[model samples]
Target: MNQGAPNRVVAAQLNIPRGTVGWWRSEDRKVRGEAYEQPTDCPQCTGREFDDVAYAYLLGLYLGDGHIISKRSQHHLSIFCNATQIGLISMAEEAMRKVMPLPTVTRRHKPGCVEVKSYTKHWCCMFPQHGPGKKHERKIALESWQQAIVDAHPWEFVRGLVHSDGCRITNWTIRLVGGERKRYGYPRYFFTNVSSDIRDLYTDTLDKLGVEWTHCTRHGNPYNISVARKASVALMDAHVGPKY
Candidate 1:
């Protein structure tokens, strides 16, 4: 605390109360020159448990618009989306609370997105996909323990993926039958992502769950995957439902 910023900033970053921080850096400690230890546990180091759905959804949020910054002296987790997506912010907050009790949530000033962040050391364990560069350039892999959780709860995992980077859409087309023109619209699900590894993992999970999808694209975009078949869309609907 002494070497860090103000009590407020430290508390916000560390996800603790300012008053508690003051106690940690009390006058007695300051006079005696005692270093205060932050009362927080690391998910990776402590091996704490987490809920499947909440953790998966948080993972989805992380994959879609969230990133973790690890430095030699400091590390933090951040997720940003349009402020209008308040549900996403709330979901991230809920997941943080479930994973640990001391996580602090803060809002930052970004152009149109709402940036909510938490200060925690277990982020790397929670999301091993973190690396030195952007997600597209990184090789994202899941640990055996995490994979076990996903295997037990595949639908929750899909829900997380679709909520963050995928959406339900209606596709339409026109055709001529017997010299008569006809228009038709059909429901489908679309998931867009930049990382091929993530896209493969998503489709693999769907494969394991017996859901069908294809690498369908628009505007020459190769990163698009869709579940367009009526039955498959129904299956996706059953599990993912809606984002909010």
Candidate 2:
């Protein structure tokens, strides 16, 4: 109903909405306020335009034959399907629609051999190309990748690296605080990776916080010895556990 946006068209033959047909755009309330455009290509001909088909087929193959996505295959999928315009689910669905339709044709093969073939032949119609086991393999690999990164200090390291990679943080030797004998024996040392402009601010902050510090070289590095303890294996391990 919004101006300058695509309107819903009721196809007489199909009795269905043809404007961005069979997509979440129809279900979302936000689409009413935004602009819409007519699709240049047919949904059946376009890439992964239909999750109802592509993801469903992949899930079917995964459940029925235990196909898994692989690292190499995932990489390939990412390379080709990275952009939102050409995502894996949409591209895959397009591939499936070209090769296998709702009512697909099948043929039997010799014992122990998969005689998978497609009637709707095209560059994309390569269903059952990756064995059903591939999906399961990919699932396991993803789980392992996730688990390997879980509870790892490298995540914090990576996060800080990313955050301070280009952005300027206060550059100054901030004092480090050592816990009292009654408290946990946490190390104390100076930290000096702060930006030069905010060095005074950082210094004042540490001074007010009652932290101790001493000067050392390597001011730009995060491991500068301006804090409570010297940067060492023992000290690093206390914050981030011993590397396995």
Candidate 3:
């Protein structure tokens, strides 16, 4: 019955009465505390093909600043974006839909941000990293399958992480060149997260991409990764430009 076979069919296969099969199935469901769960197109659960690029990006977002709620009654995957960044919000929603189109996606406006959410319990299956406490307080590591996806689409994953908790900024300095004071601007990218594991993931991907970066300390805490090399900045500009 769980495999979508009718009670009569299952009973015939098991050589049992249809009524007995139905009763046993009902009891099993009751014991499992499972209601009639809607069928899901989750790639993990259904073994269906999904948008790998979108999944990689969404995975980065999930590890950076997004989260999943898997309560019995309320289940959703949410990625919060600054209210001012309408493009980022739209991209986040698009990524969610591309990965799993069946679930309904919605946005909730908060004080200074918008929460892009997809309603479904299957998100927990998609993102097994979802846990009970703060991400930085626990061990956060990618599964083998997820790492494969990230390796295949490293730029998209980096873009997603940057869009969530990273930024591109420019700093300038004045110098005397040919007796004239000129200002030169340096553009760099920074990914700041309290999770050391997440920072490692970001740096590991950067290493694969040949992007040079360094650890930055803020307020005496080394939770920031900076990409300031000229070549690295150019690479980032080409692939993961500033989040709009």
Candidate 4:
């Protein structure tokens, strides 16, 4: 009996006659195929091709917090970002739509972050820097066309990188001007990563944007580049604003 022990099964074990108890099983019960139909699995993605801004953003996102998982015919590209970075999620989904149009991607909540993943067959072709271990341990070099894309739309690329692995925060410190002490607060961007190559790509883009950044890392801190000068921060604000 489905619910532990139904009356019919109990009666049968007790030697009660089927017709006497009126609990015999029905002969009209349907067989497996007759009663249910098999459901088809959904396709991962259909769209193909690429865009300079979108692909550059995706590349940056991949270099930061994204990775690919491949199956026989379906390879998934997933990027993780803070939930507050809804704008980045939008950009990522839009990029996925442009690059791999068929199967759609979705944003899922994961603890303090959100994950966006889509099934595609062209992930490896897009991210040639992908390899067996952590990105820091692997050599990451962009192709000529990939470099051209980043050069053309460096802001979107930096935005993707910042949203995934960097952050924008208010940094305040007290400075002594003559005799008076004053508190100064400013918005600064910090991009921290393990791979020097990835960090170099970020710095190169910042250089093209005319934003100055310095390598800043102390104990327990990751390798980072910080853009904190007022003019440089303003330049970055104009080009790539903070993630939502």
Candidate 5:
């Protein structure tokens, strides 16, 4: 749902058939729009509303695996990755609900198969030495920052290092350098799956944290979105280990 537009619901605005808009309302669905006060009931999370830091903290538990470019089972991998993200988010939500006085965060179900914008940020990474050899250049940098933080704190960190969507988090750390000698602080972040709420949250949180993040622009060699998605699923699957 684009902000400042009369379209209160995204599917309505897009003029997509009601029956085919299912993906828009799926579990762990993230929306993007302009800033507005959160209503009594969350537009995205149904009965569940944003609980400030508690919900934010729950989101911090998610982590991202660096993008991979596997040729085999690419489509299956993407599906699995999206599913895992939703599952991880659900798991975190459940964990938080047990301790907090909040309703369950459920999946969004618009209607049918409408394609909501993917949350994956398309960014490239660059290494100081390689200049070109690095994969997903700047995106890699964001992942690097995340990894660095996770390595140091392991359990208690929430750095908002992510690509374009400005909505990403993980259980691990993404590091940042400090002005002081060898002094660095890990900044943990909570992303609103909803773009409007998240944009508001990002601005408010960043301002509150006194940290600045540069927007990513198109540069360097391009990578396949499908490949990255597959890699992400594989990586997450590997990290989560085996299911009991």
Candidate 6:
């Protein structure tokens, strides 16, 4: 079974019943005090080296739009992506695999989006911020080790956040230029989140990268972080252009 063969295949090969094979395996696991325990390669639990760059990016995605379900029988990390952005979906899946390849990753289609899930309870170990209630309703803070990872891969983290809950848009205005009407376009990036803690984390990373941003109100809510400065937008363009 460890070689990816099902019990039925092992039983047939051994000329034994499937139930008997399963029972023998169960008894062996009980003897080893590992009943119902699944093997994992989690960096946190195993103290194994992993891709910190991918982890930093995934951390941003989790803070932005990801969540973990840690129920008795259900455990997984889910990151919702727009169905139109195939690149983002692929990147999200790759990041999850790079961080922990043992978990099974799958995508489920929703009304207009795709939910990418990694089935494993060890996600809670990686993301200690998981708790009850919505993310915006609870305090979200990264542990020291996670902060170190984000610090090392700030651009990747910012890119993940932008891919999840941020967007780049261009606004144009017609102005009189030397007695002629001319149109000018301004391209800006916005990171919107209801959680102040998450927004603060994004801005803090931006500050470290020397990216200027301001709080912008939209539809009577001041939950938007605007990066409209020419140099800052250029930096963002180089690192994260848009969700695609």
**Which candidate comes out best when scored by TM-score?**
6
Error of 3 at 58 (Å): 0.6
RMSD (Cα, Å) for all candidates, in order, is 4.8, 21.0, 8.0, 12.6, 18.7, 3.4
Poorly placed runs, candidate 1 (over 4 Å): 1-34, 72-74, 175-180, 217-221
lDDT of each: 0.78, 0.32, 0.92, 0.77, 0.30, 0.93
Lowest summed lDDT window (length 10), candidate 1 = 36-45
Clashing pairs counted in every model: 1, 28, 0, 6, 38, 0
Q: Report the candidate with higher lDDT, 4 versus 5.
A: 4
Model 2 segments more than 4 A misplaced = 1-194, 198-209, 219-225, 228-244
Candidate 2's residue-wise lDDT over 1-244, tens digit each? 3222223332334456655443545565465675544332223355544323333333222222222234432311111111222232243345344433432223334444332322232212222334333332433211332223222323233212222211212233444457433323444333333333223323333344343445556645543335444443233334323111
**Runs in model 3 lying further than 4 Å from the true structure:** 1-35
lDDT of 6 by residue, 1-244 (tens): 6564556778999898999978887888788887466668889889999999999999989988899999999999999999999999999999999999888899999988999999999999999999999999999898999999999999999998998899999989999999999999999999999999999999999999999999999899989999999999999999999888
Instruction: Give one digit per residue, the lDDT tens place, for model 4 in 1-244.
Output: 2233433455678788645433233322243223321121222122334566788888889999999877675677899877877888888888877765544478889998889997654677677777788899988989887898888888888988887888889988999999899998999999999899999999998888888999898685659899999999998788777888
Return the TM-score for each candidate structure: 0.81, 0.19, 0.85, 0.75, 0.23, 0.90
Judge candidate 4 against the unseen true structure and give its global Cα lDDT, from 0 to 1.
0.77
Over 156-225, each residue of candidate 1 has an lDDT whose tens digit, in order, gives 7787778778888777899999999999999888889989888987999999988888998778877989
Among the numbered candidates, top lDDT falls to: 6
Ranking of all candidate structures by their lDDT, best first: 6, 3, 1, 4, 2, 5
Candidate 2: lDDT of 218?
68
Candidate 1, residue 81: Cα displacement in angstroms equals 2.1
| Ten residues in sequence with the least summed lDDT for candidate 5 | 120-129
Tell me the spans in candidate 4 whose CA falls farther than 4 Å from its real position: 1-49, 220-222
Better of 2 and 5 by TM-score: 5
Worst 10 residues of 3 by lDDT: 1-10
